[model samples]
Target chain A: MNHLDEKDIRKLTEETVKQLGSSATPELVENVVKEAIDRIQYKAGSHVIDTSPLKKAALQQSGNRIIVTAFGKNRVGILAGLTGILARHKCNILDLTQKLLQEFFTIMILVDINESPVDFDTIKTDVTRVGEELDLKVVIQHEEIFNAMHRV
Target chain B: MPIAIEEILETIRMTEVEHFDIRTVTMGISLKDCCSDDLNKLKKNIYEKIMRVAAEHVMVAKKIESDYGISIANKRIAVTPISLIADAYHKEDFIEIAQTLDKAAHELGIDFLGGFSALVQKGATPGEQNMMHAVPDALASTQHICSSVNVATTKAGINMDAVKLMGEVIKQTAQLTGDKDAIGCAKLVVFANVPEDNPFIAGAFHGVSEPDVVINVGISGPGVILRTIREIPDTLDISTLSDHIRRMAFKITRAGEYLGKKVAEMQNVQFGIVDISLAPTPVPGDSVADILKAIGLEDVGAAGTTAALALLNDSVKRGGMMASSYVGGMSGAFIPVSEDEGMIRAAERGNISIEKLEAMTSVCSVGLDMIAIPGKTSAEIISGIIADECAIGISNNKTTAVRIIPVPGKDVGESVNYGGLLGMAPIMGCSQLSNNIFINRGGRFPAPVKGINN
Candidate 1:
């Protein structure tokens, strides 16, 4: 509940004016002080008491999941190739998205690797090989799998 | 009160603009327990322990990457130095360990497995000698195994005997893997004052003092910084530009700190450093040179580029330090030749040279990374580059390493494509003047005056 006093606000305004110099308008100084106070409040626990429906809704979506990353050149049947591979491996592609950079393509496929018979290495090698055949580069990895392995 | 839609949109935009995400969440696991006089058992123990420990890495990395929508460039393992684990084993035993590590990394789906290393900064132990002897063959035969040899330190000084031996080791490693374009050398690095818990490899290793399990994160966002600088108005003064860079760095570091702490908490391990180096990729949009250009340079490696890099590196450290308690590793700009498209382009366009790159390393982090030299460049010249870079690190009291590729059948101006993360680089010329006389002196360079603290 502690907020910046009028004197503290005035001091911050002066500091802003000094920093901004010729560009500092009264309105600009006021805005800067307001933003600073909001940031301070957020850091100082004012924003922690979330009673909103949106907050409750957001908290519900948190859970453990898997991610599959694909990177390589954009080519004909890139997505089809990936889909076929995933289907053949019996990997349930939960959510899929792709981005095109220049002529290259990066696809991210979320899947349940635990239920899938295909291991990550096989998937990676197969995908990379498929990408190679298609003249693209590909990489597949699972989320937090590395940390879980070595980070005792 | 409910947040407005506009406010929510603004928050999303800010998050996206900041590129707030974890770059790498590396786990360092010790393998000392796997060591034994029985070579087969030692190799088996090493492989089993590594595979058991690293089995979950890919899954966890993928999960984290998805939850955060950030690309975790790699999931890697750094083990106890093989010398420590192979103390009783012979040279072939060390090679077996390397092959074992390569196999485990391959099977576990990890990108690179590091700590195929020897720490002989003062002098080589019996085990260290064996590991060093096995490096060429080990590196040549492995696919994902990475190796490092720390032959010097600030306190220990440069071990010239080890350096001399490493020069020949480099030659042998290059010669052994000549058919693979000396890809083995790409997996090798030599260093001074190397950090033990570095999350990046082939450099990462678990320090002796570190806990059994710990999470270290390396955050890279040259693209974000480059994009921000590109938005800067041309009329802004240098100070203003610096301020803008500082602000962007603050946001980037804060993101790294947030994710690092979260991951450590989840993993129930101590949170290690957040490496603030702007690690670049071969991707065109992710070029570090583009960052220089965004900061007002016409091209990277051009005039004023070194000074600009110094400023950028310093400001990043300043902001990152303010944002996180644990900030370490090569916390500066990275100028990897093959890994950075802009640097590669600069080298191709003849805007950057080996000498200028060396000068730039006096300010940047990780000197001379993935630089391809001509096949004809002597082992002496390669050693000379390593010596020069190590001197810079030892003098300045920082971590600097060299990973130079002596590309076969390639000369200055010709490009060698390494594909993937290794990228591509145009071979840069080296000096003809041989430093063999000085190099063959084979004596430790005394520690700097500043290092003589009682």
Candidate 2:
């Protein structure tokens, strides 16, 4: 399994020979190599994974913030369209995460609107009425809510 | 971290789904300086004073609302009681000043203007008698003006004469506005130990102790507290439950204080106090009776309701008092019937009665609020109710008030609708048993001597 890192390749190669000793045919060896490479490629925390995509600070920042949370049936263009509107409003995306499971799409984005120059009412109106614009249930909230609830 | 995304979502959910919001931002403007022997000059002076101090109230409030994310339910104004400043005015001339206040409030886009009021707990002076006589006319003439009469206090005892007069005033006011569900009565309140800095109408007023101009905020959070109690495990004890409520109150009071301070700072006015009253609305899911029911009562007026309310009120005060620096006003749960959907349902179901409500008031905040009785109910019976409530406040040294509306021509089981937050309520039955002989005796009920230790 050349695709597997030396650590996993060595462990898998040793396990294959030990588990299938004496009856370890060429066909079995080839199958083991293929399965090991497949598992290594699909598993979490892959050795060659590009982690820059997961690190938030790489693209996001924090400040005078509002959180945009949206939920709807999983469909194409949900993330892109919502982000596109935020972009158009001059709101900088501080952090964003989206997940689609069982035909349900839930997304949350932390945004900084200080640089936008647009009034808070416009942003608030856009967020609360996002269902009309994009067929999604959306809520916009200020960060003070969390501070009041969780912290002293 | 200062706050988490989850916490922000929780507060948003509370506002969006549970009906939590700031009850009011009342600007208390002292009218003591406008007192003059010339009635016309006094009226003009009062109007200009209110306008000068309140011109930017609505605009500034809306701006602060946008700056913060929370919504302010009402922008109201409270002024010094007119009786203190109307010593020279004739009884019949008081309507002109009431109309002037209405004009000023309407111009400022203020919803309620309080303090067309008199304090005669000790004795009614000529000025106080004039203001008291003008109650019905003042309320009947103005849409925004709210009037209150303080007829009792712990230190001064109950003024039975003023109490008797108010009963007639209420009846006359109801008769004048009989076509509109007697809404004039809804705008009037009778109080014992009324708080000067209360931001809640119709008992709000700027007392002599307060500054010239001040900002007071009242927080609404019965729904928020109810939601928190529901989240707790049922196996918990009263102490544990109280702790949970106190924590929630802390957060709610913090929000109110933050908003109040911001508005006061922006307006260059002194910040008065945060009234942590759990005011309910007619909207669904925003009732104090619902909280009582959730605390293990079959109905709001059932046995053990007062105990549960006491626990809730004590905990809310404990937490809210800790959150704000200067906590004042009616800082407890108010059981206003028409304004609370659950209380309305309980009353209609025959589970809640006037007597039980009186019992609840002993442990609750305001007394007999937003209640409606039959049109045929006599003024003496209303006076008896007010007298009983005053006795409770005087003995306990607590604030109590009565804001009952006797709808003209309405009978029991029929409902009266005042619309908006004033809400609709089934006409409650009062006792046919009259106390006219006792109430007719014009003398003060002496203050209870509470000096056992001395």
Candidate 3:
């Protein structure tokens, strides 16, 4: 059975015919048919809100998750130096993003310290010291605060 | 899935630009076991017990902040009301206990330690009276100690004797700490039906029913709420405005619940309530009065101020009640004149008066908080003010407090700056007429008929 329901398949088939006219026979149009199936499958699967409690439980059980942020004049090796210290401390970088506007550079890293052997205090101290050494402003905070302020 | 980049930036922007942060993480420690006939033993016991919790509470709070990239503004402690804890002591003079608490707080790096308190709603005990007497010297002598006296409760009615005493205590506190803009009085709050788990300073204390140790979170975000309203179309009326506020409050409260419970577990203490009050800071853009203004009031004490406060208070409670199961403390919109920008501006412009503030407090979270009054204001008038606030709390069967500091040398229009969370407040003088005869009639104000719903 196809991953998509009958209505989607019918609409997709009609589009295929409209695009290729008589050349869109099922046997000759294998590539188009496969493409349609894949598209339908992806649409059906994507954007489903994860309502599972297990995911939430796992997230919290992973001990501490913090955001490491650095702001400074755009300079080379900022990310490399920061991540190098994090890697040495065995911290897992879960997510990161950066923006460079004129001479200013800003970066935020979401890190999981549950896997890291270092305590939360030492990780913060080291990250802060390293960032300062590179002449960057740094701050660390927990993840739940963001979830609280933004998500209802 | 994962938190969106927009959400991350929004959080950072709130802390960086809007002054969004946790106002306080107050650990309510019970001093029930620290009682002794010997003052030295009592002090030693308190020192040890407080030492065990203070460093650890601050450590965990700092750790949580680092892991979250948010700041915990104040790390504090609120032990069991000093009067109750000192009941076993033979001495009526409890100043030593207050000094000990102040010392412990300083050594622990805690900002303020509440519970220099006496609950005399029904009547004052000899010991409680002595503790109350020590309030002025304690407040004058100590930096970290916060004092309070519950002069009324809905069930027990208002204790006029204690009210009369507090008038004198406030004046003495003002006189003693006159050099510091009467900062001593800022550290003392007079209350009716005060909450046990309030994490905010000047009024926080561990109630008798609370656990041995617990962490209560007061989540602050007046700026965030204001930003939410501004982002929407201006044509939106009160109904939709309330809906938006309620939703935002729910999310803000959830964050507090998550943090409070997790931090409590990590610290091996019982998790306390999440106070969902939109606590305004002195910092611009973070005032609860600004929230009222964004809700379409000309200012916090405008014509529709009380109605606006009622709406904001009710909406916040509706959202916060659903977000956390244990929503306790002063969970509404706070409108302290000094602490709120809109309030300070309105007050300074003479657009808001003491009468208007009193009326608004009937609807807001706390009552007449951080209000600076004239230094020469009589103790009778101070008692009169306390009586009025207590009446509101008793009649409504809700919590209300009076934290009026009569800055010793500053009269009306002249402001006082206590700095930090204790913001600058212009002096709002009270009625010059005497309320001495009424206040001197020392007796309980009987509880209202509505006080007995249960």
Q: Tell me each candidate's i-RMS in Å.
A: 12.0, 4.8, 3.6
Off by over 4 Å in 1: A1-152, B1-21
User: Candidate 3's residue-wise lDDT over B1-454, tens digit each?
Assistant: 2566677766677778877788888899998998888888989999999998666888888777766766788888999998997875433357778888888998888889999988899997778888888889989889899998999999999999999999999999999999998999889999998887898888999999998999999989898888988888889988998899888788778777877787788888899999999999888899887888888877666799889889989998998998989999888888888988778898898888999889988887789899999999989999999999999998888888999998887899799987888888999978889888999999878988887778
Sort every candidate by TM-score, greatest first: 2, 3, 1
lDDT (CA) per prediction: 0.74, 0.85, 0.84
Q: Candidate 2 chain B, which ten residues in sequence have the lowest lDDT sum?
A: B1-10
Candidate 1, residues A32-110: lDDT per residue as tens digits? 7667766665676775433232222222333333454556666789888878877787766545667786986766665
Which CAPRI level is candidate 2? incorrect
Which number leads on lDDT? 2
Candidate with better DockQ, 2 vs 3: 3
What residue runs in model 2 are displaced by over 4 Å at the alpha carbon?
A: A1-63, A88-90, A96-106, A125-132, B451-454
lDDT of 3 by residue, A1-152 (tens): 22343345457667877889866777655567556566554565744332332233235444577788888998889999999999999987766788888999988887878778889889889999999988998887777677665665
Structural similarity of chain A in candidate 3, as TM-score: 0.62
The full ranking of all candidates by lDDT, starting with the best, is 2, 3, 1
Docking class of 3: acceptable
The sequence of per-residue lDDT tens digits that candidate 1 reaches over residues B1-454 is 0122232222233335544345577878888677677778888898888777667776776655545445566777788888887777789878888888889989988878888888888888888988998999999988888899887777878888788778778878888998877888888999987888788877888777777767788877777677668888888887777777776676667666656666666656677788888788887667678888887788887799999898888877877777678888668888898998888888888888888988888898888888888888877777788888888888888878889888777778687776888878788888968799877888777887757878
What is candidate 2's lDDT per residue for B1-454, written digit by digit as tens? 2234456557767777888889999999999999888888999999999999898988888877765667899999999998888877878878888999999999999999999998899999997898888989889889899999999998889999999999999999999999898999999999999999999999999997899999999999889999999998888898999999999899889889888887899899999999999999998889999999888889898989889999999999999988888899999999999999999999999999999899888988899999999999899989999999999998888899999999999999899887799998999998979799989997988877851224
TM-score of chain A of each: 0.48, 0.55, 0.62
- Name the lDDT value of residue A36 in candidate 3: 59
